[model samples]
Every structure is written in C-alpha cells, then in structure tokens.
Target: MPTSAAHVPEPGEGDGPEPWPQGISRRATMRISDVLRALRTEFPHVSHSKLRFLEEQGLIETVRTPAGYRQYSPADVERLRYVLVEQRDHYLPLKVIKDRLAALDTGTETEAPVPRLATADGDAGAASARRRYTVEALAAAGGVDRSLVDGLVEAGVLRPTTGGQLDAHALDVVVLAAGLAEHGIEPRHLRTLRTAADRHVSLVQQVVAPWRSQQTASARAHADTLATEIGELCARLHTVFVRQGVDDLTR
Candidate 1:
C-alpha cells in the first residue's frame, strides 16, 4: 500500500488509530496498502479497487518488486497525493488530472499557476513593478547565509530560474524560513511544508481546473469563487492543526 501520510510524518501521526506500518522508515520503499492508509485522510473514499483502477487508467504508475508487489517512492507518493486530491476536491475525472500531471513532468511551471495556500492582502493578480534578485541580494534581504541559500537549493527548498536567478516568492519563503530559524528550525526541516502546500494547491485545482475548459462564463466565475473559498478553508485548517499541537504541548 502507501507509505506514510503528511508526506514526512507530521507531529503525531503514529499515535492515531490507523498508524502506518512500523519499521517502515520514510526512506524505505512501501507497498500499495501503505499508500492507501497514507492517503485516506485527504481522500477518505479511496479503496484498493480504486487505486488499481488508477493504475489501469494510467493516471499513476508504480514499479513492482520480484514478486510483482507495487513499490512506491516519495515522489510517487507525492504524485498519488496530487491525483487523489485533485480527483476528490475538484470532482475532476482522472483524465484531466493525468494531463496536468504530464504537463508538470515536462518542466512546464510557466503553465502551472503558483500554488498558494492563502490569498494575500492585496490583489495578487494586479500589475506591479517586476523585481528580481541576485543571490547576494536575496541572502541579505532574506537574512539567510549564502551557504544556506545554496543548501536550500540542494534540499529542493528553493527553485532558481533557468538563468539561476531568485524570484520574489523565493525571497518571501526564504525570509519566512529565516523567521522560523529564530526558533532554531532549519530549512531542511521545511520540505514537508512545501509538500503539504502542493497538496493544498491540488485542492484548489479541483475547483479551478475546469474553468480552463471552453465553458460558460458562469462556470468560470464559479471556479474563481470556489478556489478562493476552498483555499481559505485549507489555510484555516492548517491554523487549527497548529493550535491543536500547542494545546497538547502546553497542557
């Protein structure tokens, strides 16, 4: 089955009623059942036949071992999370999710909307003066070390452009990471945050993906409303989870 949920073992996954398998570390390969348990939270309707159907439908692929048991990688889990989240949240047919995934596989971020969990205070779509930063400028502004910046890239925490320049979002996240570092958390520890953020985007995609269809204007407006509303809901859930953790700790 699937491996672990929350991508990398959240604050207290193991204490749950349906804890994932013991002795199966995050770095270890996992079976299909493992994948299902990991996914059941976000996609409660998931089932064995459904996963097999996805395989049959060619939405997701898995490698088999000597006995032909499915083995999945972290990347595979991330892809499955994307597919399931999209299908459940958007009521998207597998065909559309598969195409969007294929587009992502081809380094097509230009076509993919930047996935943000919270709508910002200002009009994010409104025009503003463009800005770019050299690594040094980014390091100074983000209040991170030059070596830490390179480490962020190595840890898959940052994505530089084709010309190797940092984007505004890059600075924003790095600066946020620096703020977290005040409590001694490292950038490396934040990879799970990025993965969870992608899953949130998958939720928005469910509402927004259909709008791109040559559908009616009314349908497009519905997509816009759902995206913003659902995105806010997801962000609220994240806050609630953090509050729960704090409650558990301080008591």
Candidate 2:
C-alpha cells in the first residue's frame, strides 16, 4: 500500500485542485493503458486523452513512479465510475460533478444524486472489510517467531491497533516475511525495505505536495492512487531485478 502522509497541504498548496482517498492500499494498481482498456467496454468513446482531460479538470488524481508513471487504484476507478455514470445518465458537466465531490470532501452530503456505479455490469466492488488478528495469532498464522514479530513492529513494518490487533495489511506483511524467514532472511534484514519505502515516500510526497495541500476528498484519494501505484512498481522492479540477477548467474 502507498504510505500516504497526512495530506494537510502546505500553506500555499490548495490553490490548485486537491486529491482523493489518502492512505489507500497499494494492491491492484492499474496503468493508464489498463484503466483505459477497462473502461472501453462500458464507454466506447473512452480515450487516453479523455482520462488526462479529466485529471486536468481535477476530476481524478493519479500516482506516479520514481521515473514518473501514472497508477490508479480501485477507489479512483470507483470515482471514475461515479463521474462517468453521472455524465452519461444525468448529463451533468464536470463543473457540477466537481461541486458534488467537493461537498463529499467536506463531509457534507451532495444535492446531486448519481447512481451507485458506472460499469455496465454494475461491478463497483470494494476491498473486503478489515480482518483483525492478535499478535500471537498473527505470529502462528505467519509461522514466524514471536521475536520476529516484535522486530517487525519495532522496525515500523507491522503496526498493531491500539487494541493490539493487526489489520489485514499488516498480517499479509507478516505472512510474506515469515515465508522469507524460512530461507534464512530475518526481520532485521527487512529494515532495508522499510528504509527504501520511507525514502521513496518522502520523494513521492514532494511530487504530490500540491494535491495534498488542497486536502479535498478527491485530491487525497488521487495522492493515494499515485503513491500506491509507484510503490507497486518499485516492488515489482526490485523483484524482477533480483530474479534477473539470479537468472544471470545460472546462465
């Protein structure tokens, strides 16, 4: 998941449009091409330029990689769902839609009513609800030592709720680390990943500062969409490079 900072935008930032859901999970990021392809079936007129135009209109915010690539999350996808549905059905312009979104950002209700979803099949789904687990239960499930679990928490990798329960994302991290442990990697060694994430997050934070400063619901979400996608690409690139290194030695 993208490490979304508190989007309390800097003093000078909100002049531009802000973003969408902050702290969105990095799972299931979509490239611009992928998003365009997915929406094509529903809106035959959907185009790359159209999505960019929507972004320019502050309709959506996207994530960017270290080298600059756009990534979209399901929340962003869902928002697109709302926008397109409203446009096609109500014939509302972007200005009208933006106002409704602003109301939502302010935690107020919007007078403009849009259908629940935009997809033709009505498949605007969401991530499953949070599944909580105790530290002991998580350790057992992940097959990692208790000490390792402690190390992960200490290293700021896994965070337990105030009630001492781990959310699904932390649990998933534990499980992955546990599998790596069997191969002689240890939690302490995992700190590099954490460090890398922190540094990249700071860099990405700089890139998205303007959007965050605005502190809009859509702006926050857009920052999240962008961060999560970059994180995904970074992870994939790391894994691919490591595999390539191994393949090279074997060759």
Candidate 3:
C-alpha cells in the first residue's frame, strides 16, 4: 500500500484525470477486464489488486462510469504497459518510474529508458532480468573481448563476486567501458572513474548514516530513499561539471 507523491484522484474522490500532453487522451472506454486481458499476455502476474495498487501509487489513472465501474482507456493501458516493462526489465522503484512519467507528461527529458513492448516470445526486448554473469558471458554480452574484462578485473574497474561471477552492476561498467574503448580509452583509464564513484558512495552513506543506524524498519526505509536521492543528485552534479569542462575545452 505504498502512496505516490503524484496527485491522482481516486474514483469518486476528485474531478477527473489530470491534463496530459498533446496526442494523449484519457477517455475511458475499456473495462478493467479488458485491460487485464491486454496486459496478461506479457505481464502474466498482473491482477486486479496489482492494478489497484498501481493506481493507488498514481502510476495509472482509471475513470469511473455512472455505475461506479472502473474503466480504462488506451492511453491508460499504454501507461500500465510502461510501468510493467520498467518494473520487469529495469527494476526501477515506483517513485522513479512515476517521476519519469510525470516528466514525460510535461515534455521534460526524463533520461530514463523508453518503454518498449515485450517481444513475441514474451522477452523484454533483450533487456532481460538482472542476473550474474561469468567473465566470458559478460564479455559476450558487452560485445567485447574477454581480455578487456580480464584487464578491468585486474585494474579494479570491475569486481567479481567470490563465486567468480559479475553482477548486473559490473555488466553496466563493462558495457560503458566497451563504448569508451571505441574512443581509445582503456580499462586502466576507468580507475579514476571508479575511485570517484567510491568517494560519492561514501559521501552518500555518511549523509544517511544516522537513519541507517536506527534499528527500525521505517528509519531504514527512509535512509534507503535518502541515499538514492542524494546519490542521483551527486551523479547529476558530476555530469554537469563534466559538461562544463568539455565546453571549456571546446571553446
């Protein structure tokens, strides 16, 4: 029963769905059963309660008919699809997804991955579930040579688990390094970035240390959210600084 920061009026609670961008419509025509049928082929776990919960979280909007039946429009269905895809493929928290959706509505650049429909085989368009990968598998996934991964491991740019498997985080690093490799940057050049990331993580942890130290569930949850927010802000600030530096170089 998580609440959303976005303001979505409950059925019979408010006037109607909020205004959206051009080309978006909220006219209710399909029933909840129709929506379920539309979604369940790809999202097998969707249910009435799950949809209700997402509505409660303000991820989707539903209109009530004169008989008080909940009705969904095509736009609503697409929005639900986006939510489900993000959750299944990216493991994004609802807060982040909701914020992205709101930004989309306002014509803001969300910087989040675009929501894509699942493939015919029900796979999430090769954006599969997060899992660990061996060095060979990681290299294959990144379309890079195994030696590059080995070099990253040697240079402390990638840390494998004690079981010798690299987690999803390592895969991202490998993929980025592979792209940077096209620019002649090597694994050794990534050490500074890794060191800077560690410093940022330490700073975020220090800021949330008090709440994390509390032995209560609420406190721990608050600390986790605070950590994520602070971490994102730090990353954005870093990006701005880098862009500024690049601008100066170009000038």
Candidate 4:
C-alpha cells in the first residue's frame, strides 16, 4: 500500500500527531511546523534544512523548550520573511543582511535609495548621453592622456557609453586620473587600487548572492542598501588600515 501525507512524519515528529516530546505547548510560541507553513506559503521551496541553515547563518534565532525542542516566535517568522524577500529579490548575502538588520535594530539610518542607472528607451537614451563627450572633451574632463582613457576602457575600468563613447562615470574616473597626473601620479601607479576595488566588489557579491534567491521589491531594496553601506564600511576600514600602517612606520 502507498503511504499517505498524514502517515509521513513531520519534522521533530514520531509516527502520530501526539504532543511534542517533553510536553511542549503549541500555543503562544510557534512550532517548527508553523514556520514551515508560513514560509512555504510565501516561498514554496523553503525546506526544514533550509530553515536550520538560516538559523546557522544567524538570520533568525529560535528558543528551545525545556525538552530541547526549537520554537520560533511570531517575530522570528516575520524576520525570516524579510530575509527571504531580500535574498530572492536583491541577491544580498546573509552577512550583509545581518549587518543591515543589526544597524536597523540599533536605530542607525544608513540605507540609501538605489539610483536607476539606465532607463526605458534604453539604447537611444544611453547613446545620446555618450555622444555628449568626444575624446578631447573626455581628456580635458578627466585630466588624463587620451591614450590613458583608452587604456582605462581596455582595462574594464571604463565601459563604453552611448555612440561608442565612454560613459560619464567612466569619464569621471579618467578626469580624476588626469588631475592626479598633473601632480606626477600615473594610472599605472594606481593599478593595485583597481585590483583592490575589484576584490572588494567580489567579496560583496559573494555575501549577497544567497539572499538574491528570494526575489521581492523590498528585499531587493534592502540588498542594494546593505551592499552600499557595507561597501562604504569596507572603504573606511581600508583607509584606517592605511593610516595605521603609516603611523606605525612614522613611530
């Protein structure tokens, strides 16, 4: 005979729907079943092991009953919803989400709205924007050699904008390099800086990818905000480290 759904053991269960082991109460506090049901309603693929994984990630905390059974609260369920929403829509990693949540908990207002870089009517609008700059215009703006601008593009530091021209942001980087060049600095000298930046970006991406799996608008916003905040933090830490190194050398 085929086994039925009811016959199958629910998580933390035996053969039947008997009281939870150790006489745990199903009221007030939520059981694992309630969490699974709620999460499944919103995110159908949520599994018991995934929930356990979330707990391990420190995304949610559970209370244990006297008999050592895990119990989730209503608040815990809501937090899980928030976390899943962020991960699916925004692709935020667990550590970034946790840090953002911690900041919110401490009443820190560090989140910023994401700016849309591209718009509808995409190619034409983008093209028109790029046509505004010529090679001379970009050289003057960024203060770098026209050849350096080309190198930056080749290096993937600046992307081609509309009309096959460098994008405004990419031009800005060249412009900044140009200013530095007047003071005897060169692009080659800053190659390590670019490499460091790329490494930092990869670190942030790895941290946010799991959260990107749970797509929702709010979650996406949260992930973007968290990424920005964490990136800023990493930059600040790098600055501090450099300063500390200099200080030690001077001392």
Candidate 2 ranges with C-alpha deviation above 4 Å: 1-129, 143-145, 161-163, 215-218
Per-model tally of clashing residue pairs: 11, 14, 0, 21
TM-score of each: 0.44, 0.46, 0.57, 0.43
Candidate 4 TM-score, C-alpha based = 0.43
> Which residues of candidate 1, in runs, are more than 4 Å off?
1-129, 215-222
Model-by-model lDDT, in order? 0.63, 0.65, 0.74, 0.61
Residue-level lDDT of model 4, residues 1-251, one tens digit each, is 11111222333456543321213322326678877776664465566666766776677667666666677755566567667767755666778778776765444634622222212233442343344566667877766568887766666666565676654566668867777777987667667778888888888877776666656644554455456556766777889999999999999
Per-residue lDDT of 8 in model 2:
33
Worst lDDT 10-window in candidate 4: 1-10
Tens-digit per-residue lDDT, 153-205, candidate 1? 77778878888887767877787777887898887888888888889989889
Candidate 4 accuracy as lDDT: 0.61
True-structure RMSD, every candidate: 22.0, 17.7, 8.1, 14.2
For candidate 3, write residues 1-251 as lDDT tens digits: 32222343333344533433323444567788888887776776577766876787788767676677788766677788877776665656779989888877666744544444323455553324446799999999888899999999999999988999987778778888888988999999999999999999999999999998987655665565567667877888999999999999999
**Ranking according to lDDT, highest score first:** 3, 2, 1, 4
Steric clash count of candidate 2: 14
